[model samples]
Target: MNVSLTSEPLRPVVQTRPVPPALIEALSQRFGKQLSLAQVVREQHGRDESSFSVPPPDAVVFAESAQDVSDAVKLAAQYKVPVIPFGAGSSVEGHLLAVQGGISIDVGRMNQVLAIHAEDLTVTVQPGVTRKALNEAVKSTGLFFPIDPGADASIGGMCATRASGTNAVRYGTMRENVLALDVVTASGELIHTGTRAKKSSAGYDLTRLMVGSEGTLGILTEITLKLYPLPEAVMAATCSFASLAEAVNATIQIIQMGVPIARCELLDAVTVRMVNTHSKLSLPESALLLMEFHGSPAGVQEQVETVQAIAAEFGGDTFEWAHTPEERTRLWTARHNAYFAGVQSRPGCKVISTDACVPISRLADALLDSVLETQASGIPYFMVGHVGDGNFHMGYLIDPNSPEERATAEQLNHQLVRRALALGGTCTGEHGVGLHKKGFLLEETGVGAVAMMRAIKTALDPDNILNPGKIFEL
Candidate 1:
């Protein structure tokens, strides 16, 4: 009649609340064929480019309008079921995973360029629109959005991550580009923040708050982004260096001297080798810097000349120029695909990407130490960075099944993050503190700051249904 207890301590049980049958029925009737419970669809909505194991949502709702998003959130709130907003599915930090089981509200169907104000230098778009699409949409007007995060990431996704890319050094990240937003709050209420105006000293900075909230506080339906006029002249080039330290030092000098380089990227020797093989280029297998200058012909020439002198001071060679637009696209395409090239270089290996940003003055030391430490570990890794902005990525290739390899990569990442923090930098420059950097966020921001963040989350989403378990655990 009596049962004996095991000596081992019982693991804490995870309480999973199931979606209410009536709510599911209501959603099915409301969304009709737009709601999908298919396993394939749910699985696809569950994971992103991250190495995290797939945890599919209970259902997927393809929202085509802001009202659809509002209705879905209302239904989820009524049932107390998690609601995860999804865009292009291009995130690499496990931001899209349904860790606590939920319904994914797919906003990709809402893709549209609502309005473009060429004179005002602003564009309004649905959250589902991708960066490439927006650029093409605005190409005719001789203006473009500059927040290119490598991937053709959706505007909503990029805004949620506060993404920045190579051009960020000149045009800034989403935090600066986004002028206004239409957000669907956790309680299913729609609110507008900011306006088409260039600057506003209005009450609370809600626009900035929702820009990088990762859909926890609200779902972005529409975004108004700042645009820049297309430069009259553009030049792209690559310079080779004897060592990573030299390359980074050259970048530091360029920034220190106030050179207006549009894009400045760094690729370690290993990364260049991979890029050569995968991109079919003959780049030298050495530390390299890829740069782009945007301005009038004379201005571009001046900037290039100054950067060339700086590079020469650090033992850099003459730049290999991509003179034509096609050539420039080809070169930047290769740079953007560096992560894929690194993965392809190591057959059957998965990448564990690390992002760290340090002050410009300390970038050289931080990068040099990271390279040495990672190399000492004997792990296959590829390094690339938006050096102009003091942000970089190191993708460590490892067999996902090998715990030893994972541990080695983790150790390298930990050391690099600690070094960055010591240098008065952030653990992640552009990538949000998704599931991957939750612990690092705590370390970077003290307990009090994190507590304040949690308080904000609680105040906005009392039921904790929106993208649960992201940034931090409630």
Candidate 2:
């Protein structure tokens, strides 16, 4: 049962310094039949998602443990080879792009749950463990790690990007869930940041500093994550509106009312249409809102009633409920496949899915203005978002070869970032400041903060060997 991944394409061989035969021999001798320079290019090269920036690494090494990562870092440091940590390869931003090509440390082989302290409500896992795998492993214990971020992204990459998803409205992002991390620093020394003691008043929070660093500061090897008890009662509902503004306004009201939503997403008319066409669903060509509630049955019902009343005030239509697990899965599957559905709408064009998060009160205005701006530019886009968290993604379609369309899409993206920042929100909510959002980071975080970050980067990675030319272009 060989399941070939459709995302992996045969990219043209990009130019980079070739790994020396002597170095390859050294690696081969060290790993004993487990290392090869040729296999790295074929297997662990490019990303699994959209196209963005530069090429893949010169070589790849499959890391099996923390020591393996440290050893690889030590070798890369000695040889002046750039090391880009590879997890599930699911980053939309080009965080894994080997701009200054060297060795890509593939951490997928290190997939393991080292410990599950159910009583403590924290689980320790290697960098390679996927979120879905982690959740499944802990399901029987009535606990789950809820920072979703759409894809089955690796725990390490999720931490790198500081990801948040559908459940972030309730459970929070990786910034809050990650308790500790075992990282191999730029100097090839292993260090642990944070503790599993629920709270810490320690000096300088290095744990959070690495959370959204996007593999620039260090290579994550192990993570300790807080878990939540599986909800005793859950309900999923979908509501539609004639206009997206109506749906968004209703969401704003729901949040203002403190309805305690577990998940709330907005789907614009274009997105609904795309999903209907690609996923073969009979959804109306109107804006839609999907909401989920989790708690005691009585508490969930009370919250749902409040949300329903708010929706009615804002022209929201009849709510439909998914009563079964299969139905709920099918509902969320359409949401998860938004990027695929949107890209499929335009032939020969891949998606440039960018995210921006604005304040809850300003979400409707920012999104509506963005829609108008995009429409005025005649660019095709699909809008989907975690409305409760005020974080939305605009999936723009552009021909891979057309510079005109790429420029147009980029302009729209920049405008979205500016609007999000002006509205007192972040340019990127989940996706870190990889190559794509570096300019926006400058605009949002300002010169002083960015300089401090760059100084930290320099202090940690003086040689600039780890993920060179990413985030801040020092």
The weakest ten consecutive residues by lDDT in model 1 span 4-13
lDDT of each: 0.90, 0.84
Model 2, span 379-437: residue lDDT tens? 78898999899999998888888877877888788777777877888878888877777
The estimated TM-scores of all candidates read 0.96, 0.94
lDDT of 1 by residue, 272-321 (tens): 99999999999999999999999999999999999998899999998899
Residue-level lDDT for 66 in candidate 1: 100
Best by TM-score: 1
Candidate 2 clashing pairs, residues 3+ apart or interchain: none
lDDT of 2 at 405: 81
